[model samples]
Target: MSSTTQTPEATVAVVGGRLVTPDSVIEGGVRIDGQEIAEVGDIDADAETVIDADGQLVLPGLVDLHGDDIEQHLQPRSGARMDASMALASADRANVAAGITTKFHAISFELDEETDRSPELAATMTDAIVDATDLLVDHRLHARCEVTQKRCVDAVLDVLDNGDADLVSVMSHIPGKGQFRDMAAFRSYYENSSNHTAEEAQEMIEERMSIPMETIRDRINRILDRAHERGVVTASHDDENPREVERLAESGVDITEYPITLETAQRASEVGMTTAMGAPNLVRGESQWGNLATIDGIEEGVVDTLVADYHPPSLLAAVFVETGESLPERVKRVSAAPADAAGFTERGRIQPDKRADLIVVDPEPTPTVTEAVVAGQPVYRADATTGESQ
Candidate 1:
């Protein structure tokens, strides 16, 4: 939980760590000059600070394209609420401690009859995330716009127009499709999460199904257009089939966030779309909702990026899961691939001239983040007694 601000003359050299580059792992370490990586080979010159990472893995800081764990911080329990800014600050501490230096806070614009996720609350949350500039890690907004909720479209558009949205993802949580494709699962989720009865959930599902397909399509296109005009990255959530993938590709979505099936993910990859899966899925070895297993998708070479999703710490552990790829390649799935999917060309790799966003990890007894540096600033360090950061 200790941090250090980087001065203009501040320089750091991490020596003896296993440096994970985009292509290879170097036993030698790296040198950080100012806010950029100065060298990736042997460092023979003197430096202001030197961290001996002798038996650790030194890799680029994780870039999470989508993480919604902040919601738990905002409302730790039912009927309990905390200030959005305070919650965001707490989330930032957790994210940085988890070795995630760059995080896109996924804020939902979906209005629920039984929840406080109204349009007004969404705007307030977006502003809170935007105003939280004092945080140590880089925080961006990923506006999850629900196309089924026509009333929320204008609010999402406002976020895009005002430049509060760094990335916009279109999602439709209507029961019978997307994440809740199985009616049994949908009923269970609605009854458990919203305290809705079976009859009420069915009625709600029918009402959502009554919405015209053209209306949903038009609203999604409008939001995507606005996001594209503003040069923001856009994504489509829970693609169900190849036709949905084609539609998203045609709508100019750069990334596919969570395909429900392996075929759909493969189709997205075949169509040249960046396919993203949740890190928790890989770590758990299965999808939570009986969807396509992310490990299988990785083995099939269809999944491109691994996001933290609802668990911020899963990104680091997912890199060590036994995928058929090399260590460098697996690390790229959580780091470089996510950064590239989010249109961040400067980070996600430890190379010369790139931003000095790095993490020192102890990979032996357990994969844990020992230290995390973002843009040459030391943001988090693990406690020696508890072996935990923050």
Candidate 2:
């Protein structure tokens, strides 16, 4: 972040902010030369465009590795479906406004999913995400594979081979395992998440439990193999045991998303995998499903990245959560660490010659994204106080 850059020479410059670099924070500005960061700190030359970042914090834009907010956008209300393009647009704006420049939309292919997330809908959204070019943020796909469903496994494989999935994760959420270690909790989660009645939820849980462990492992292995072959980052969801984490790490998994226990998270870190937890968990101080707290993971040095999960804005809020760390360290969990976890190298840190993806944050009463810039372009601003500076 603190690089020895040349004299300021660029088309656009953001001036007068506490620039949070990797090493330290400085009261300076950043110069953007087209699509790259031309210079940082001590800019004196005039430019055609200038964003007045006075009294704010200028940090690299967040790179969210996984979020399911797109699904929420698609069905904002019950029993209704929005257009694919519209949903993508809304989600893009939401993420960018939340200071997220790089987003991995987690689309799940599951058996007992709601009506809005059919196989055809998943395919449509996949194509939509790929074909979209007018988005403000860099949108990528994270295909969530529910391995108990053959259709889900097959769909993820096709998407992976076609180069549509940037990140792939294997999810086997059968009862009495992982996130649902308690049988009563499994029934409650299934009954609440779908249209299934109590009896139906029980039946579905029993049916899923009947799926042989061998078959589930086989399906997960196939997905992991293809993901490795395609050179895409792979993740295991809601890991519960150290043994399971070790097995996934041996298989070359790059990340472990939301390990349910501290032991599992430590095992993931010991085996050389990036551990990610939900930003909301950090903001709310606990997991939504009564699992390991994100603060515990951060304090234990087990978690390396913070994802949006279902709440896009929580990422920005979590940054200023008083985690007993410097702002630069907390910022890296959402930006540099996540970018590295996802195998991206172009735009995480605010260094010279890196992609000029940045955000100006107002950290007073609440942490809010005042302006967001992606690829050297000013894509969003909270107000009109961003133009030429004298």
Candidate 3:
């Protein structure tokens, strides 16, 4: 009798790792046939290219809904701006290194905030995000409209009308409200942000406080309306209380990001709106503004998504922090949850027929991304070819 030999035909196989799926954790491997996953558990390890992930966790690539790190990359120092393409490329490397497969860059539009970088950068930044193909990770535009300024609203609406922005969020940062509820901290923060004198910062804060809520709401509604008509997702930032959450929910805001209080987050959840908190808040165990701690929302089951905010690494670090939840559930906070919140339906979980966007994580003394694969192609790989991290 003649026996025929079987050949492994997968493009790449990530083996010997605990796979964090959407609903469960499996002690097996995954195979990428091409751009999509072919097998989930007990995958054939003899593929053309095998990545041994023994003693590590194989997680879905992180989907960062809101990250301000792009701005920092654009302007590394006060009054010093780098080339837009170069800055975006740098941010892309940093994000993929942290296992972020999809990144929503937050572009703030404000008036009279010269040090916040020119509000004109909004159009330039949005164009860069849409046109750049050199970026390794998937990039989207998050238009952050500061409602106190009508020009800011106009700019964001134009982006929406042009179908350039993927997400839209309305925020009003008056000193006595929202995240700046602590007026002292607010003044101190403004003073420290630039060379502005205490008086100049106070003047700026007071100027914002003078804008009536009626005016702010009108500007906010216009942007929200345009965004909705364009089928773009909307969010309200730094909600202060349940009443405020209710108001935003009534306005058809689909998300509440960085709710300042636990009650606010709970109200958002109760009203069927998705709640997102910053990953830095969870990693730090408290809010910099002394607002509701992110753990409070996690313990209460209110937080539906965790964004990168100003720090991308915090997202990966948070999954290993032991939050009393299974690894699969905790992994969803950064991957599945944010991906769903951002309306990215195709590539958040590790499953057959899904896009092969995955990360090999070594969670020993800390969680570090060793290899990142997007669309079945390796984008980054650390020099761990010899040790157990291979």
Candidate 4:
């Protein structure tokens, strides 16, 4: 008879801190073994590493259900580029420092080769993500597939079909119609904020906005069919109207990312699609694009997850800023809600058998992350430097 030897589980007991489990906050300790949480009681046990939380609030590590923070890493400017591996490394470290254990790095696949949005670059980035994550926090690819990019959809979908894509978003950006109907308003975004000349802005928009809306929507349906078949989550980006929300729901989209208006947000909620708002919007005190305030959406009970958008630390910062009635309840907006939205059952909660991804916060109005543990390993320590620099 052949027998196999079982591996011994490594355990660490975290005691004396305020433990924030999924169900409730306990003023006690937790025990973790290897990559899973072991206990949550007062059992005296030795640990390889002991974190003295010292009355700090212990919560699950933040889950960024949506964002494009990594895009800056790959492409620092419209024309400038960097090494894929280096960019991923930098972005990954920034994300971990922000207490993000799970990240969905939004990469836009623009159809036109001249647009600088390349499938080749995305594939390279995805490969780097798989390789670099061996010793780092969990990072995944979220391709913001502009439905208008008819030529690139096939290539982008190929990545998804091959398991290269983690989250696929279907978005349509047409000028003088849909989200860009207000040409004057849209002009301000490209002209004033981006500092693009009228001709340059028009050309770029013309290149992206050239595709027909009907064709793009039809293509979205096709991609959704494939995504559903693969069990990959689908999200509708920048929903502007009720009809769009209804259509996305019919297409089996569960996440509605950045609904531009309040009506669209409400419609998405009515349809039971989890709404995602930008964390930077919350941190900056308002939306840069002049959309519905995330705070308002949260108040209306329409917002479900907080995405980092452009800055990873904003995810943790937003939680502190929104603790109006209760801190634990507000923290859940960043932790549990986004984790549930992303369909990650193990990492979001501080429960036994769950992945030991947790953080210790100072419990102040502008709380700082004291420690960050991912899969039972310390990835960040505030005393080691709190914010991103370099």
Best prediction by TM-score: 1
* Candidate 4 local lDDT, 273-319, one digit each (tens): 98999888877878776777888888887888889888888888887
Compared with the true structure, what per-residue lDDT tens digits does model 3 show for residues 245-285?
89889999999999998888988999999999988999999
The Cα error of candidate 2 at residue 343, in Å, is 0.9
lDDT of candidate model 1 versus the reference: 0.87
How do all models score by TM-score?
0.95, 0.94, 0.94, 0.90
- Which has the better TM-score: candidate 2, or candidate 4? 2
Q: Give the residue spans of candidate 1 off by over 4 A.
A: 1-5, 385-390
- Whichever of 1 and 4 has more TM-score, that candidate is 1
Q: Rate the local accuracy (lDDT) of all candidates.
A: 0.87, 0.87, 0.85, 0.76
TM-score of 2: 0.94
> Tens digit of lDDT per residue, candidate 1, span 18-57?
9999999888878888889999978754777787786689
Residues 1-390 of candidate 2 have per-residue lDDT tens digits of: 011122344377899889999878999999988779889999854877889997699999999999999988899887788998999999988888889999898988875554455555777888988888867888898999989889889999999999998999999888988888888898898688766688888787878899999999899899999999999999999999999999989888889999999999999999999999999999999998999999999899898999999999999999999888898999999999999888888878889999899999988777878888888878788863453211
Task: For candidate 3, list the clashing residue pairs, or say none.
Answer: 52-390
Weakest ten-residue segment in model 2 by summed lDDT: 1-10
For model 4, the stretches where C-alpha displacement exceeds 4 angstroms are 1-8, 77-80, 111-115, 177-181, 192-196, 207-210, 323-325, 363-365, 384-390
